[model samples]
Every structure is written in structure tokens, then in C-alpha cells.
Target: MKSFSILLAATAASVLPVSAAVAAPAKNIVLVHGAYADGSGWRGVYDILVKDGYHVSIVSQPLTSLTDDIAATQRVLDKQTGPVVLVGHSYGGQIITDAGADPKVKALVYVAALQPDVGESVIGLAKTMELPNGDVEESADGFLSLASDKFVADFAADVPKDLAEFMKASQMPVAAIAFSEKTKVASWRSKPSYGIVATKDLALNANLERWMYKRAGAKITEIDASHVVFISQPRAVADVIEEAARAVK
Candidate 1:
């Protein structure tokens, strides 16, 4: 009976650790891409998170209207069962600012993203910066395209040549009207926010990136890359996101 009791105590000790491990929380990561890009932009980051055992989802924004894009992101946020680390790039930051209001969203990560303030439109923000002339071409049909020549020189110079080319070719035409639409709510105001500033970004000037971070009161991480920080500095961007994920629990 003494030996059996000792074995039973050993079993309980072993089971306690396993039970605690199983009870620990799981992290969920949601990626939102900015204008002129699709959800595929998150391929590298998504793979990294998945390998680390994170539940991940990438939202495909229509790039049509602010309300529509926010609604699309909100739909994805709604499906998450636990705390979520919402990551947004460029224009996507704007989407998260509004869609990230849900109680489930534990943190927000902005990658060289726009952190617009209350009642601010893209036009209002861009007006303060000296964006290259003719960088964005507007069609008679009211769509906007990122000039191919500036794709690498302006937005993605630090990325590999092939990947930059691929990004250029895959650019989606965003409705011109979307830029005029202002954000009604800003989630960064309430949520724990993190910002990745791309120092060499030409599309959104480096100074603007700093401005956004300061305005949003986000914990800032700086990277010496172009506007597409995730493509040029994937690991660094992922690290910031992982930190945000860790903060949830």
C-alpha cells in the first residue's frame, strides 16, 4: 500500500504540469492589408505565426470605402474565439482603428501604417506630407493606381527585386473616393497599440510615420526599410506582433 501511494503521488505531480500547460491561453493573430495590396501581402508573417502555433486570419479588404473595409475587418474580428492581436499595414491601419473596437481585440500592431486621428481623411493627412508628384495616378473612372515606376523607388526599395516586381504587378486599383472618407472612430485611442516605423518609406514619409506613432500614443519600433516593412523586415515586424500577442495574457 505504501508503494502504491507513492506511485499515485508521482502520477498526480506529472499530470498537474500537463494540465497547467493545456490550460494556458492560445494566441490569435489577424492581419489586415493596406491599399494597393491584398491579403497575400501577409504571406510571410502568416507563415511565421502559424509555425509558432498561433491561430491566424488575413482580412481581404475591398479597398472600396472606409465603412465597407471596416465592416469586412470587423467580420473577421467577430469570428475569433479568444483575445486577438490585430495587425494592420498602411491603409489597413485605418481599418483597424475603427474595426478593432471589439472587446476581443487585445492589441493593435501598425506596420508603417496610417494612424489617422478623429475625423481625419487620407487627403487631410497626406496634405501635410510632400508625397511625390504623380505617384498616384487617378483614372477617369475614379480609381487610383500606384505608379509602377515608384513601386520600388518609393514604396518598396528595400525588398528583393523579384518580390518588388511581383508586388508592383499585383497592385490593386483602389477607388479614388476612398481617400476622401474620414474615420469616425479610432481604436488606437483605447487599445494597446504598437507601431513599426519604416524609415525609408517614400509613400508615407518617414516623418509622417513618426507623427502617426506619436499621435496614436503607440509603443514604436523603428525599422530601416521602405513602406512595405513586412516584406523588407519581416522578422522585426513579426517580433513586434509577437510582443503584442504576449501582452494579451
Candidate 2:
């Protein structure tokens, strides 16, 4: 009778749903926001991923120091048990490029984001190409911001007027010193990557976005949107991330 009971218990455990067996190690999606923004920028993307049954988290970068931001991201990466898909937008791209080196990160997705090479600072990368709208401003505090006037036309052109206005009003100040700091490591060099190019992006310039994508050897996806592609096209962003998550080894 005892042998029969043990065999029955083993059979039942083997028949459990994959997701229930050992919890199946949920795949993690870490959303990293760019300059003049916080993790809140990923709210829409986060909501969608949640509905789709994904384990997601957003990294609220201080925008104060590159090392601090990378460390913050790494801290989150360290907590994840399974594979991670690191997604970054705009300057957030720089953060992921360095932080994604964590062994837990299986793939990278750059959404209208910068992908700097080794020894390249944000300024150095920007200088290499001509941007459509020159709207970046350097403040006396040694930080960078977008000129309020250009916020609508350059940063959030595709978004509704009201939301664009809100984004302009709530823009975070990014430390200028952060732009000069070089990424000691760039994960895209070795990891598989996907790049989304905002065709109408005025902040970074569409051409420059494409150039970065090609330079990084990323599988490219183009969207008719502004620099904040994730905000204007959350579904598309989520779809690409979903694809990357499933493809992770």
C-alpha cells in the first residue's frame, strides 16, 4: 500500500502544469527609462506586460551618475531568477548597454535609444551625426535639458497635445556630467539585440537612430513615432519585448 501511494504521488506531481511546477521561473523584463524621465515612463508598457503574464519591473534611474544608474539596474538584475530582457529608451539606452552585461540578461531591446560603443560618451556619439532638431540645453548646474519650446515639436511630436504638454512640464533634469561618462562595458556587442527606430524622432534624429541600430547589428523595427516611442506605441514595444523574451535561451 505504501509503494502504491508513493508511485501515485510521483505521477501526480509529474502531471502538474509547467507553470505550476517549481513556479517555472518567471521571465523578467526590466524597463529602463531615459533622461528627463523616470520609471513611470514605462507605466503603459508595464501594464501591458502584466496583462500578458510577464514578470516586469522598472528601474528608476537617478539620472545623476552613470555608475549609480548601472549599479541600480544590476541590483534588480541580480534578484531575477530566470532570464531577463533589458529594454531601454533614449539615454536609458546607455544605462542598459552597460548594465545588461549581467549574466541574467539574455537579450537587449533599444527603443529609439542610444547604443554607444566602447569608450563612447553620449556627447561623443551625438557629435558623430547631425540631429534633426537641436533642442538640447546645458544648464549652469552642469545638467542637460530640452528647451521647453522644443519639447512639443522635437520630443513629443507624435503624442497628443495635452500629454505632450504634461511631459514637457514634468521633464527630469539630467546631470551633464553623466553624458561624458563612458560605458566601461557594452552588452550589445555580444548579446542578441533588437532596435526600434522612431522614424519621426526629432530629439535624436531618425537617421542617427538607424545608424546606431545598424552599428550595433541589432534586428531593426521601424515605427512612425517620436523619441518616446514606448509612450506613443506601447503595444508595438511590448510585442517586440514579448518576442525577445520567448527567444531567450
Candidate 3:
């Protein structure tokens, strides 16, 4: 009987590794930032992911045009040696919705982002819903940016004032036409998706986030933060990203 027990223990030990392998998280994670912000904003989330053993890459795509942004994301995806969990925030959602179609991408996470379907433009969707704060402005040359005075209140109300001010000072002005360009693909339809809704978001209506995420059939998490949920709630955002990664085969 003792020998039989010892044999059972050995069998359990042998199965442990297979179980672990099956549950292992996806190794590669690519984070995409939206217009008016750069990849630097992903620092909080990136640090958390790296500490948790993820190989994370943040795409700093020039917000020049939809094609350019998508190309930039695809370039990053090409560098990964294995499957990737592609994540996007704000306008970056439109980017991932198109770029996530890459064969190497295993899943997608949208954080307070615009998930536009094929033939749909960000401008088109924004028209369907009214933002709580209309603090954004367009330049004479046709670039779009948030008004400096309203940046903290509109975009990063939950983050520290200093950081929000810096984000405002360093905001990337996306071409106005970028918002008018339509997406050619919607990857969430094919890939497993997770969504985070910032219930206190003012820049983009929180209700719009719920509608888009639900339409895409994304697993959703709602947090009481501003538009920059990834910055204000990095730990929670990382948790959802890791959840998406684990769901990947």
C-alpha cells in the first residue's frame, strides 16, 4: 500500500508541469497609446507587467494617420518571437481593432478606447455620443489636441496634477484627418477581447465604452477612474491584461 501511494505521488508530480504549461500566460504584450498621448503613458502598466514576467512592448505610433498607426503597431508585432496580447487605450482602440488581426496576436484588451468597426471612423462614432467635456480643439493646420487648461480635468482627472500637467505639455497632436479615416478591419471579432470602462471618464463617454465593448462581446471590467484608467489604475489594468493573456491558447 505504501508503494502504491508513492507511485500516486510520482504521477501527480509528473502532471503538475503539464497543468502549469497549460495555464502559463502569454509571454508577449504590446501596448498601444491613443491620440493626444504617447507610449510614455504606458509606463505604469508596463512596469507592472514586466514585474509579473511579461515581455511587454509599448508602441509609440505617430498619430499621423490610421494607416501609419496601424503600420507602427504591426511593426512591433513583427518583433515578437511568439504570440502577443495586443492592448490599446483611448483612440488606440481603433488601432488595435484593425492591427490586432495580425496572425501573431493572441488576444486584445481595450482600455477606455474607441473600438471602431470596419468602415467606421472615430469622428463618425464620436458623433453618436456626446462627451461630458468638449475640451479638445483642432489646430488651423488640422491637428487635434486637448485644451491645456482642461487637460487635467478632461483627460487625467484621477492622476496626480503634476503628471497630468506634464501629459498635457507633452501631448501629441494627431492630424484631424486621422479621426475621419475609417478602419478597414475589426480584429476583436476574431480574437478574444477584454475591455476596461472608466466610469468617470469625461473625454470619452463611459456609456459609449460600454456599448462598444458589449457589441464586440468583450469581457468587461469597470473602474472608477478618468479617461486615463491605465495610468490611475495600473494594477487593475494589468490584472485584466494578464487575464486576457492567460485566456490565449
Tens digits of per-residue lDDT, candidate 1, 132-220, equal 44589888999888898877788778888998899899998888788889988888888889999888788887788788898888999
Cα displacement (Å) at residue 97, model 1: 0.2
Cα RMSDs, all models: 4.0, 3.1, 3.9
User: RMSD, model 3, all Cα superposed?
Assistant: 3.9
Model 1 quality (TM-score):
0.88
lDDT of 3 by residue, 153-243 (tens): 9899999989988999999999988899999989998888998999999999999999999999999999999999999999999999999
TM-score, one value per model: 0.88, 0.89, 0.91
What is candidate 1's local distance difference test score?
0.86
Worst 10 residues of 1 by lDDT: 17-26
Deviation of model 2 at 234, angstroms: 0.4
Candidate 2 Cα errors over 4 Å, as ranges: 1-26
For 37-119, candidate 2 gives per-residue lDDT tens digits of 77877888999999999999888878988888898888888888878899999988999999989888989999999998889
lDDT of 3: 0.93
TM-score of 3: 0.91
